[model samples]
Target: MAIWHWIEQTLRSYPELAIFLALAVGYWIGGKKFGSFSLGSVTGTLLAGVIIGQIGIDISPHIKSVFFIMFLFAVGFGVGPQFVRGVANDGLPQAVFAVIVSCLCLFSVYLAAVLSGYGPGLAAGLLAGTQTISASIGLATDAINRLDMSADQIQAQLDAIPVAYAVTYLFGTVGTGWIIAYLGPKILRINLQEECARYEKEMSEGEPDGGMQSAWYQYIVRSFKLTKPDFIAGKTVAQAEAGMTGGERLFLENLRRNGKIIEFDANTVLQVGDVVAVSGRHETLVDWSNRAEEVADQELLQIPIESIDVVVTSKNANGKTLLELSKSPCARGVYVTRIRRGSMGVDIPVQAQTKLHRGDIVSVSGSRKHVESVIEEFGFADRPTSVTDMVFVGSGIVIGGLIGAIVVPVGGIPITLSTSGGALIAGLVFGWLRSFKPKLGSVPSATLWFMNSVGLNVFIAVVGITAGPTFIQGVKEVGIELFFWGLFATSLPMLLAPLIGKYIFRFDPAINLGCCGGARTSTASVAMVAEAAKSNVPMLGYTVPYAISNTFLTLWGMVIVLLLG
Candidate 1:
């Protein structure tokens, strides 16, 4: 009894301890599985905060704003490049589909809220929970605070937001997954795996690695002695490579003549006793007996080699296909292992004809010198680093805040974007600019993830704790009707997703499901669909839509609140 009393007193005296406790316990709860459905950390953290808040702990509202702004900025930064691409390029179909879905989501929630006679705060909570766009909660909160109401009324509305969110988030997470993964496939009436295979086959412009099955080492390097005089002995490196007949191309990186390693190029002549280091698919390199004897030339094979991810930024490489790039002199000694495109940077099916976009990241491997040259020719090398450029981030937030603070009175009603909205817009611009000028605004993926996840979770934890005192009462007031309304709002737009993708966008069956999953901004739904289809092909259509939907859904939070208010 003494220990319990001491612990309670400590938590009360130092309320910050409660926040960390809620976070730890909340993450643990979120990680647990409840029969194929698990509450994510956001929902879990919010609930934990609410439970902990029952101790009547009072935390400053400013804490919530700080964390919320950080999260909004991170989100905008992460999706900025893709958002711009979706708007300006061939991703327009998927972008349009996502916009329609987002609009429908807003309308559905508004309709549900109005029908249920809910206030703006409750409506915002429903929108956030049903869409599973946790960022919307911040927007809604900002909108509610802007309303002309008494302090007590404002607190009442603020307290009601979390109650509605906690109740509806369960269905929002699991229901969206079911509709996209299972229901959408059922509506299409096509075997997912077969359709995916067909689509993949159609997309493959050339037989990858000579139609060879993927081996442990798809790209490998081997040293061979030029023993066959009739084969490659008298030919120049370029001439010798020209004589080879196969789907896969090999590049010679080093040559050892007179027992000394020398850098060789296309025009370099080959001698009978020279040992050459060749890089290509393992399958293609396995048949070296016909041209030369395999040799373990340590000095020749042990040259400096590297694999780096290069973000495509050069106009010379943009819109070009892999096959086209491969023919360039700059690509002679480098091998592209993967092409990562779209918003999320997930690897798409890379073939000879896969086209390159300005921001696509191409993973290439070769001799260090060769790789560096390719990196220069292609775009910026995203070298592994732990440092983040804080100057750019700080400046963007300040500028965005200034921009957002501008108010334009429409018919005597003062309207402003609020600082949060400005931060989001600023993040987008900064993130996009970073793609063009890689040296500036370098927010590494790790730092961005921290800012995105911890920032949002911490803000939510504060919101939960603050609302905890009124939570039970808020739930009781909102009643069971809120849950049903959430279901209605969550289901309506998701159901329309597939139909819109197919009939309007005319997307492939696999891509249709992918776009639907992305439109809902549900990673779990896309993962489940990929599992069901037995391919990552669905992810091909995911990135652009995900980027588009994520941006708009977050903004809808403010819009819904304004309409309801």
Candidate 2:
């Protein structure tokens, strides 16, 4: 009894800690069983924390801060290498496009907030970050501090931003992508899949040496501690090698301005600025500068475009060989260089007349417009325009929304339903009943990773910051009413956003819900859609939405907070 009492006392002292622990435990178990129970992760964690707190357990704010920082650092490190590579490849253009799209979304939200009568700074703060409510909170906090607002006012603003941002973030990730995919061909006047094919062709032709400077050059100069190339400029190969050890491997090659590597005999004398090819470790090659100079100037072909991905379908040019396809009039100037087949994940070169099969994704490269045209001309099946397609899309949204509503309760009163849970239940019922069949497209691994990582980090940071001491204190001071209010604040936006996405944006259902997962930064919804879809494009679509939503959510949060406060 004493030990039980002590344990109980410990729980009472660190309620938040207890809740955090429960959330972690729930996530681990749920994730294992469901292959990432993301909704469970969020709601489970939150619920566990609440339960623990109710049982008198408490946790330190300092600990939460540490966890947040560590999580952010992990995220940064995880994406660093990819980020660098992205910049090196023609990622600059894509990045620019993504940013522009993101900004446009942000501007839209800002306009909404301003028109709704929110102050400029608060609107800016809410609009500044990605879907993460924590980021919006941080921005709002900073803005408040900068404006020298009183602590009370600042805290009030911070308290309300998370709820608003969360709603927008959720909508953007899943729904936005579908909207883009569905309308992009008309609005952006481009087909993404075709664009992907063209990019593949360009990457094939350019083959930019793996973005690495020759390792041979580095090894020779740095490792061998070779003498600097100073005296060998005008000497013959034999003369240049007069004092060097292991000099026989060294050779001189010449080209007449036009690039042609011609081997020079040992007696061939070198001219000033003559290009040379020298082989040996650094020290030995150092004295043979004139020879090295000739080889160093080898002209490299400039590749205009970089990496791209293509999805192969059964309808793709009747399973033609990549070489045959390239030779076709339709494939002119474009080359199918590499093929990444399915989730098996290996890249192989295109062999001539290698017969294509259904579902073999190929990468091709060429000008953007040309690539787009090629895909449009020969790539994928046209979007289904049948009434059946429309019905499927509609039913998906209704069922998904119903599931989400069932899983998580609104107003924290344990209403025995959640928006996410409702969606899942609906999916299971429809799938099991076989009455309402849903055709979910493919969800890619890259898309999954991008949306989950980017969306969640932003969400956590924004939410945590906004729910600072003052906000929490208010909840505590207000008692049960606050809990109900908090629940309402959280669920209302989630429920409404998808409805708007569906009716207004005409987004695909899976894509719509996937954005909800992204906005909340929940991996569960991502995995669910991934499991449901046949292609990864939906995942990519989710990411686009998540990114866009983050910007909007941030702005929306600030606007709501200031206006209400």
Candidate 3:
């Protein structure tokens, strides 16, 4: 009892300890797998904070506001590029569809809240929890505080948010996965694996095994002795290459005739017993392996090869197909292994006909010199770095706050994008700008992850602790009925998603399901659907919808509060 009392006293005296405690415990719990589902870190942190809040630790409200602003800004920045591209390019259809789907989600949750006689705060909470959008909690809290109400009334409403969120969030996370992986295919009446396999075959034509994410290199270099005298002894290197299948994809990197090293030249005549280093796609190399004598020539294999990410910014490369870019002088001897597009950096199908967008990041592998040329030709090289531009971040937030503070009176009620919303907008613009001018606003991916994940979780921890004292009372008032309302809200949009995607949009089965998952902002559901289909084809359609849905659903947090009020 003495030790327990001392611990409680220490937590009360240093309330920030409670926040870190919640984060640590929450992350540990969130990482646990429970049959393909686990309570995510945000939900886990909120629950942990609520339990610790019974200790009555007092924390400054300013802590949550600062972290929430950072979180919102990071969210905006990450999705901005993809969001803009989707709206402007061929992805416009998916972009529009995502917005419509987001509307349906907001409407469904709003209807559920109104029918159940829930107030603004509870409505916002249900929407956030049902949609599994952790960011909405911050926006909702902001909206509730903005209302013309007493502190006591505001605190009471604030308490209701976390309690409702806790009750419904589990089902929201697990249910979405089930719906996408199991129910979606049933609705479409197609075999997921077969469809993915068929799609994979179609996409993989003329392309190497760069179809999935793996550590295995899909391209290789091998040393071959010119032992096939009858077939190639007197033929020139160019003539020999032209006669082989997939010759355009192959490169004779180096050669050693007798005791002398020879540089690569297309007109060089082949000699019997001459050793050559050849590089090409793994499958193509394997097919032709038996045509020559394989040798372990250490000197020939010691070429300085490199793989690197090159951002697409050059206007000459922009809007050009992969086939066209491959023919460029800069692309000589370089192979494009993958293309990462959008905010989430999801890998899209790499095909000859696949066009390069200005912001797309292409991964190319070849001799270091060739790869350097490709980088110079496309855009800046996306080399790994640890530094972040604090100046850009601070300026963006300040500008966003100013933009959000402006108000327009609607029927005597002031309407404004709160500072949080403005920060989000600023993030979008800054992020888009960064894509074009890759040198400025350098927020490293690691820094963004820390700002995004830690910022939101910290704010969530604070919200949970603040609402802790009233949590039990709030749950009692709302009862089990709130759970049912959440179910209806979550299911309605998801249920109609595939039908709308099929009948109206006419998307492929895998893509339709992936878009639905993205529209709900559920990464787990998309992963689940991909696993079930045994292919990553689903992820090709995920990034654009995910970006659009993230922006729309977060804004709905403020919108729901306004409607319910």
User: lDDT winner among the candidates?
Assistant: 3
Query: Can you write out model 1's per-residue Cα lDDT over 1-565, one digit (the tens) per residue?
Result: 9998898788889988998998898889999998777898899899999999888887888888888888888888888878887888888899999999999999999999888889988998898999999999998888888888998888888888899899899899889988888888888888889999888777665544553122212457789988878877878988766637584566677889988888788888899999888876666787775568898877777768788899987878877777677767567666777878654667676666567877788888768867888888888898888988889888888898889889888887678888998999988888887777788868887888888988999989999999998999888877598999999999999898898888888998968999988888888888888888988889878888988999899999889888988
Q: After superposition, how far is residue 396 of candidate 1 from its true place, in Å?
A: 1.3
RMSD of each: 3.3, 20.6, 4.7
lDDT of each: 0.84, 0.39, 0.84
Give the least accurate 10-residue stretch of model 1, judged by summed lDDT.
Answer: 209-218
Candidate 2: tens digits of C-alpha lDDT, residues 1-565: 9997887776556454444456565455334444222332432333333333444332443443333322222232222222332234423332333343344444454445555554433343334322324434433443343334677765555454433333333333343333333432344334445543443444345222421112111222111111234555556766854544553333222223224445466687655544444434355555444333323333422213322445443344544655445534344434555554322232333444344433345566654433554666554422323233324323644555554344333464223222222332343333222211113332234432333343333334324433533334544444343233333333444445455545655554534444444444334344444444433333433333343333334334334333333
lDDT of 3 by residue, 156-228 (tens): 8888889888988988888988888899999899999998878766654454334322111335789888777
Better-scoring candidate (lDDT), 1 or 2: 1
Candidate 2, residue 124: CA error in Å? 8.8
Candidate 1 TM-score, true structure as reference: 0.90
| Model 1 score (lDDT) | 0.84
Give residue 293's error in model 3 in angstroms. 15
